[model samples]
Target: MLTPDRIDSEASALTGAVRELARRTHFPVSFGGFVDGGNAHISAIHGSRTRSLDGLNVRVMRGLGGRVMAEIRPRATPDYGAARHITHDYDRHILGEGISTLLAVPVIVGGRVRGLLYGGAWASANVGEVVMKPAFQVADALATELRVRDEVERRLATLDGATAPASGALGPASPRAQGGAATPTEPHPSLPAAHREELRESYAELRTIAAAITDPDVRARLAHVEQRLAALSGDDDTAQLTSSVSLSPRETDVLACAAIGATNAQIAAQLSLREGTVKAYLSSAMAKLDASTRHAAVTKARRSGLLP
Candidate 1:
């Protein structure tokens, strides 16, 4: 079975995958990633679309790209003004890119518009099935990522957990999602690579101690800490959270610290963890947050109401 960690790692890979596809494909390819709202704001604008001439807050059902998302289908338009019904709304953004003919496809997942993938040309060229083929492939790859993340989440949820509405409807002591109390609740705006590396070391040293420690009092303390870190470490939200959210409690403490901008060495000194162990927790949390960057992960968490 795919572990939560694997699922998140794979979803992240798709971002690069989709981007590379646009760069390699001969068309003036661009991908505007999924925005939080119904209207698809440009998350990533590539090729010609990179040259922005308008503002954000693009409306659906306006231009070639907007229409594609509004209709939840693929569309090819030879002239922007020709689509008089929708042209006026998004003409500026598209025209600035020097687009005379364009194809826009939505990256649909679970009946929702995750993002949009586009291909266009400067002249009125007929972008037939041949031109459209690879575009669909790219969109498909991006859309499929959601399902993989969802599956990992399901598996992670099944491992002796608690279910709180992500909205923070419950109190702080409502208990951890996976049957524990010490886990902290909050989200990151983004999680950096250094944060991830910190958590990585934490999880490793923990395993080392779990197997060999023999003192009764120390063993009991370690056992409790392990369960908490396990719950914290193992959550899967590739589109939403990353390595996995299934972490043990102590691990959650580490994540909370990093979320607050704690350095690995600082976290180590504060929590009495070796700097290495703190790195492990940060890395593991980065995966659970499914955030490629520190800021993004933090945003995802706050938006989900994870960070209270």
Candidate 2:
């Protein structure tokens, strides 16, 4: 396994991502950290004060971390003590820090909880608005990155003595043409108007495959390709999108929750929406993006700046 330093670095990227997500939100720039048995603990104690801690225990399947590890789902507590079914085991430490609300979303990759990104509100019913929404965004990105990293590690685990057709990426393609200054090339040519439409469909599908990929290198490369195609083919500009692609506030909720790998049932629960209503929102977003699949719809919306 790679050192905790590498893992932490990968996880820390979520900080900037979350911060940006919450910038216009109701959150006032809170901080979060993932603690384990080893190394110094982060996710500093902050409510009225920010205190750094060392040597905090994060046992598997206990407290917020434990439940996330067990359920592999994002958990939210609007009023920690007031909420039912919550074990306030961490209340002494957390309440001392002046936290009133908490949200912990698990970073589950390959069917295991690698770590958690958690935060709380000292005094805000809007914690669900400012904190939880962005928390879900960060969690989704974390899930994507960790899942990709795990897949890369698994594929790399095989050696010359082993025989499996390398289940993931082929690694960096000829870096010179890409890494160096070079002119772009033309896409395949000589197709009818309908054929061009089909190519657009194909490109969208390729982008979905790229984002759906569970390997960081491959996903990154595929995203690059998708971006290039979107730029050249005029598919990426949100300004150029049909009005149908634009999502309303409620529809955005559906798409954002979906981005975090939330199922209809789970999204309905989280959004306090009916299951049928959730599906309706998803279907609407899909129609706006002209996507045949949920993944493609998400990739399109994300690329087009419709969803952060």
Candidate 3:
């Protein structure tokens, strides 16, 4: 279930994306919002001249943004009022802001339309690749973040219902409960095999998400969650093994992808690293774990509580 905090965070993310769109494309007006029910509520705006766009609720199939939402692709018009391809449901707001050219992009995630982003100018102008490219990039980045958050929330919900530490705490307490330290180990026996697999997948996804995030606070929060996941999958007997082993963040990321059976090339693409770089990281991780192969490295890392 979506909580108030989650909704606020989503809005903040959209607002930041809108600000970035305006900055990168130099659009005179940029705004966007998430779709709730059937309307795209315009909750974020930048560079707007007037209050005409405030509180605008764009309905699907009714206007350019709406059509973008319906089509799940970008749409633009050089002359908003004279454009014959789209309906005039939003002319009062669009024209009221003196916008002559408009571009709209859909925020698609998991093959579904999650939100809409828009950029516009007061003078009629062509919307070409130069403008579209950065707009698309911002939208895609936002979509990726949203997808990560969704996965994290879903997995956390499952974990909340699954077994927790005896102290009833689900965070750092789990690690200390094992042996007064933080370690990664084999999956807890009480958790079913399917749940353990799900936890591993979530941990891998979190690592990927952490790699792309630039905000220190967000990264810290994700790291905390990653630690909780690691603690939950630990084995009591191997809790002391982690003191002798330490893996860099990149090494751990590479191993997390490896844990999910991803090939070196796949890990490279996912981590935005060269294949050679991926190999080097893998080799180093294997050496540090004192393993002869990638598979053995992953196993040893898990047994030493270095991985979950």
lDDT of 3 by residue, 32-132 (tens): 99888989999999999999999899998989988988889999999999998889988999999999999999999988789999999999999999999
Question: What TM-score does candidate 2 reach?
Answer: 0.45
Query: What TM-score does candidate 3 reach?
Result: 0.85
Query: Would you give me the overall lDDT of model 3?
Result: 0.84
Can you rank all candidates by lDDT, best first?
3, 1, 2
Q: Per-residue lDDT tens digits of candidate 2, residues 9-128? A: 565555554464345343433444553452113443322364422224445555565576567787766677676655655666556666666676665556766556656667745355
Cα displacement (Å) at residue 251, model 2: 34
By summed lDDT, which 10 consecutive residues of candidate 2 come out lowest? 181-190
Name the lDDT value of residue 281 in candidate 2.
Answer: 84
Model 1 residue 140 CA deviation (Å) reads: 0.8
List all candidate RMSDs to the true structure: 17.7, 13.1, 3.6
In model 1, the Cα lDDT at residue 247 comes to 49
Local lDDT at 270 for model 2? 67
How do the residues 1-308 of candidate 1 rate in per-residue lDDT, one tens digit apiece? Answer: 55665444544544554575566556665555553566765555456545553344456776666777778888887775565656666666677677777777778888967677666677787767776777787777656555444433443353223323355554566555335533333332232445333433443344444444333433454455444433343223433233224545555566555565667787787677889887776677667767786555545553333432
Candidate 2 RMSD to the correct structure: 13.1
Best by TM-score: 3
What global local distance difference test value does model 1 have? 0.56
